[model samples]
Target: MRERNVVSAQTQLLSTVAPSQSPSFDPDLGVITPPSNGMARSAFARPVAPRARWRRRYLACLVLIDFVTALGASRTVVALLDEADAGFWDQRVLGGAVSAFALVTNLVVPLMWMTVLVAAGAYDRRALGRGTEELKRVARANVAMAATVSFLALGFKKDLSRATVAAIILTLLLYTLVTRALARVVLRRIRRVSQRASQKVLLVGRLSDAMAVHEVVTRNPGAGLRPIAIHLPHHPRPGERVTAPVPVYVGWDLVPLVQQLGADTIAVCGPASLESYELRKLAWQLEGTGLDLVVVPQVTDVTGPRIHVRPIEGLPLLNVEEPTISGLSLLVKSMLDRVTALVGLVLLSPLLVGIAVAIKLTDPGPVMFRQTRIGHEGRAFKVWKFRTMYTDAEQRLEALRHRNESDGLLFKIKDDPRVTPIGRHLRGLSLDELPQLINVLKGEMSLVGPRPLPTEDDDYRGDVRRRLLVRPGITGLWQISGRSDLTWEDAVRLDLHYVDNWSLVYDLGILWRTASVVLARRGAY
Candidate 1:
């Protein structure tokens, strides 16, 4: 496993590419480097640098984490080794049997387990880069290993204590499950902490198709794609954002397309979805070019759990499962939210009071800030929060616009004068957003959904704005990923994704993710 040399000292990021370094056409491949040492080589080079080395490092880190957890958990079995239960007696008897078993089991099981991952095609370089999918793979691999080991032990008449074995199994499984997930999440933030993940890829389709692909990928920055140019077999319609800012090329321009864009991947999701022959040719052209050819299917709002890709005789088949949401399922969410939110409100009441008091003392203002944010079906209602700004912050908004750094309808600044001293701390760790439990109680909001947006122009927001289809939440996908630091486009994308894929099980995951995000606070500002 390659480890990205983590730069230990605090340092500021410098731009890797010059402003004028724009490629002549969108990249067919090779624009972003693997995240290296968390350093931006572009900061010093000609805007283009070899970065496969960086990817190697990031992948190595993930492998190292999984290895440590599995190896470390194996050591914990030493504790259960203490002074002996039956079937597994003294050091020599137990030791010999267990040690022999351990050696065989450990060696065979891990490899077998890892083999399952390989069989499942779980450890593909690209798949491992994405967090959620990799998590499922890790869990699946561990479960398979446990089953195999248990069966083997039983057959050999050397079965250890069920409790000890179970503990060992649980520890091994949990460690892999957790550490793999952690490593993926942490690597993303740490690796891309300083530099943006900008992939140079070529768009293969009509103008509308190219534009749609660009929009979708842009909305998911964590996906790590940056289309530098476009490829059109023929002229696309005028007024289509076919080449917005990025250059577009014709079929005859393949050589320039590769050279000018420094493209590392050819993203085919356009009319080519209908063009098998050209798609094949495009794949052939990209071969040996060190550029990946990725074909994006029409699948949307679907997670790995519901989608299975199988290849039979070189024909790839994609299977999308029907949604599991049912009436009883929704009830699970409502009940869970109500119980959890209610208990949380009561348990954290003292902390809430402390926040309110601090806010009042800092700004001589209402301890709670209330503002109408759009909720389900565009219902307007005030969401509550411990005051994180001066009482006059809104009234003084006009003056702060010049300082606004957030790129979207939302306003955000890392160090806003409007934020009280206490507010900054609350905002950092997210204590400031706690008062929305009241909104949940009132049925004006949900315990989890998109962050409700505030609007005043219309009688009610529209469905495009209808993200209000679900009740708003106190913390959500947006909150966990980044509160204010996210681009406006990404904020809505997550909200819509959440709305499209809402489930009780999904909500539980969101809440868990929210805890980790809070501690890391990568996007707090």
Candidate 2:
């Protein structure tokens, strides 16, 4: 009777708590369970089964789309081959034997392409909403498929148009990537409307650790894991309510709780909270349940490519590969940066001239803004920008310091008196930074890298100074993420992430996202 009274009172308190704050609850150790029916429409509950079915059907549609895309690509390639190499087709008529073989090859190519996609796990539900990794897997599968097809033809001594096959595979790869990108955009919109489609997660950890992981997951909705409930087996204050947005459950029996909540994922944050025996028991209980067990390491800012899990003697050991700091690849990146900058300057000369003319006519000051900035290896360089502030803006900075909106090491104000009338619009669209293309050409920066800090503000130490290993960029991860809207810690984390994992493909992805962010004018000044 006492235990029942405790459960009832805790449930009542939870019901009264505001939705914005985390709920606090008293631990109920006895058989005083929450009402089963109430679990269906709790603030965190959703129709999990229906959403799962819908996703399966959605993935099926994507598979059909890929199948059609492969067929179309093959036929298009054959037609191009016909036009480019007419003699090859002409030779087919000699007994019509070659023509029959050509027809067979065309039909087989698309089928093979579909098989490769399936083998790649491109249509897997888990891979659907997650970013880049899905696309990278698709690329890898197509490349491997192409190589396999080539080897088979060589080994069998089969006569075939290798160029046409290569072209078709390339087209298929591109089509798959483009369609998947569109699907992700649509999926995000659907997820916003039908939250049930998001991966439901059961968070099991300390209150502090749960909250930290919660912040990351909530911030990146595109990453797809949604915490529906939190399990604080070791809540510091048993009788005190924990402040959380989701339902707070006390004690661990994670398997039973997960089954009751219909959670698709169980996220265990931090290593210290769970014992080896408990984790092993939980893993055994989770077998055949179809629930994904995600153990999030305390280490932050690590990406998928760096992390590898190797199983030895029934134990999974995680290996994090160290990033290479220098190589011939860096030389190639530099060459490409200079070439791209040279081309951009020549093409945008008229726009640059117009901006200079506008600045001269609008404000009686120099058309360019040159400031000393810390670059590679902490070297100082005079970075150039299209002037967007009044001449006395520097002198006016001290008075507006109190009104700064940014946090931790950065100063930003939504509305600053120092900005000239014309400057506001320019900064809004990021046109003020166009002059930095010259910096790229001058070898002080790359086309894509960490954002450079002002020389006067440089106080980097230890790991923070790693950003100086490569040339700073005109635009980068920080630019696309939030610009002036991001906190100082977030900016540092992103810069450090880039420093640890810099690749040409990553640079291109950043450049692509930069275009979208710029056009949307999101998180701009």
Q: Rate the local accuracy (lDDT) of all candidates.
A: 0.65, 0.78
| lDDT per residue as tens, model 1, 147-198 | 7777877899774668866776778777777777766666566435543444
1-525: candidate 2 lDDT, tens digit per residue: 645554665466456433543434445332123333323313223223213675777788887877777777777776787898887567776767775756655667767877887888877777886768788778988888888788998999987667766787788888878888888888777776666467889888887888899999988776667897777756454455455666667643566566656677889888875887778766666666677788888778777578888999988888888875578878989999999999999999999999899999999999999998989998999998989899998999899989999876577898888898889888888888888999999999998999888745358776778889889998899999989989888998899999888888889889989988988888877
Residue-pair clashes, model 2: 6
Cα TM-score per model: 0.71, 0.86
Candidate 2, residue 336: Cα displacement in angstroms equals 2.0
Instruction: For model 2, give the 10-residue run with minimal summed lDDT.
Output: 41-50
Alpha-carbon RMSD to native, per candidate: 9.9, 6.2
